[model samples]
Target: MSDGVRLNKRVAEDVPCSRSEAEAYILGGWVSVDGVVVEEPGARVGHDRRIALLPGATAMPIAPVTIVVHKPAGVEVSAALIDPAQQEGKQRFLKHHLHKLELVAPLEKSASGLVVFTQDYRVLRKFREDAPEQEIIVEVAGTISEGGLQQLNQGMKVSWQNETRLRFATKIATPGLIDRLCRDVGLRVLAQKRIRIGRLPMSSLPPARWRYLTPVERF
Candidate 1:
């Protein structure tokens, strides 16, 4: 430790800003060492490495993050959501983001797609008090008749994309509700995936990879 100074201390002295501000600069991806961006404020440097902020960089407050992970079939939601390798997004990774995350709208191990884990209390409260009002869009593969489709859409809605895909929209169904509903209608389900929950869609996120749910994004 005596051989080098903490990067935050170096940056703080150079920028003439507070120690906390320097930490913010590093966490915000504004600080670099030898022309390479380094996010760790506690990184040790021996006075040899060139360190500077990017052009017009600002040390803005780092907000709590929400992650939207595309869970793969047969993978447990808890395991998949927290894995470091599964994270894929532009958001800066902070160690704290992995703690105190409230997992929402859990899917079964047999099912897959669009699982959310968040540290934001507002997002948690929304799911807590208004979950029943949220419309869930599930894409499934099965067979059903015109009459059965009519029956399936009696209180909700359903769309037929092809012989291999049928989309169902519902208001907060249980983990196995779709399977049970399809079974009741004589439809044999081959596969099922929840593509959307409330207004958030899975979009192009590949399986097992996750992206940040930005400040503007809501469940």
Candidate 2:
């Protein structure tokens, strides 16, 4: 017999469920080895060790939830953890299930709209790994010359923070591009907000309010 195996694999082999379900049970504090609770799925279990599923252990897999918050300007995404009141939702479900939340693609303090928080690792991984483009609407009060407009559309290299960087006029806007537009393009930006991430739009999510992402919603 092997000296040790991953906890999830051992649970999957002994229990009538997949490895993912086993992991969920473990994370939910349902699995114990020699009377000690082991929460990590990757925890090693000796072959000779006694592994037991607690009486209240759930056999079903828990689906991860993703929350879409219409974050108002000046509110930090990280503030949600310190003050759940910052999350603008009257739903009781939001109160009970807000623990272990992870923020994704946080907006700057000066900007507003569509901040995402999730318990799903897959969603977090997708955003981090993909570095998907975003859509932003910037309200500026300045005239652009015909030549400047053409140059914006064609993309330009601007000096930013003592370094040169490429700025594009496509729907996607990054902090660097926004800074270059105000400093180099000679535009006075009055407001800027992100409206879309990937194909997901802020849509009708009221300012400072939030809602759970529906099953049909992806990223």
Candidate 3:
């Protein structure tokens, strides 16, 4: 290619490995281009450049891990990753389990619901490639006018940045919109919980506990 090919693709073509394995080697800091180590799989290199693997750079298979946690209110989603005491369930955390455990789709501190963490790049890539549709249940006190309900259903416009410009990226399921709707209708929101993401539901998952995704499960 004129602009150079992705490092991973070039590595896979040159080496006896799959693209994913090449990526793993790159991420593990085992790949060098023209004597310089390049960690990014998507790094560009000239077609005629030198590519080398360091000693002990044999393909080592890595198992992907995906964990689902039932988050409780008042706990910061990001903080809970390091603090196992904040997590639910009887399973204890091991030091080895902490490696590359990345939190996904973190919820607000005041919200309680399912949270996801994974060491799998494929799972993370799926989320990044497409915005997963979420379903949330909001509890509010007081009454909502019929007009307000209609407006909410039809997607009302809200202004931000000192009301100088309106946000074009408007949606009905966003938490901000829910809060605005409740405030406009003279209601007080008590709770908000995301119950579903994509086709996965937080069914039967107890609060403050965590579980691993089954082999057959996706997302």
User: What is the C-alpha local distance difference test score of each model?
Assistant: 0.77, 0.67, 0.69
The alpha-carbon lDDT assigned to residue 114 of candidate 2 equals 73
Candidate 1 residue 149 C-alpha distance from true site, Å: 11
Best by lDDT: 1
Worst lDDT window (10 residues) for model 2?
158-167
RMSD (Å) per prediction? 4.7, 9.6, 12.3
> Candidate 2 on 21-113: residue-level lDDT in tens?
988878777888899877778888887888889997885655677888787777766635324454444532423246678877777777787
**lDDT of candidate 1 over 14-112, digit per residue (tens):** 887999999998888788888888887888987887889999778778777788888888887793366667677766576657768778778877788
| Descending-TM-score candidate ranking | 1, 2, 3
Worst 10 residues of 1 by lDDT: 132-141
**Candidate with the larger TM-score of 1 and 2:** 1
lDDT of 3 by residue, 1-219 (tens): 247999999889988689999988887768899998887788888988899999888566546667787788788786354455654445434433456888767677787887778888887887778756666666667765667555555543432222121222222344355666667866666777767766678998778777766667775
Q: Judged by TM-score relative to the true structure, which candidate is superior, 1 or 3?
A: 1
Model 3 TM: 0.55
What are the clash counts of all predictions, listed in order? Answer: 0, 0, 3
TM-score of model 1 vs. true structure: 0.67
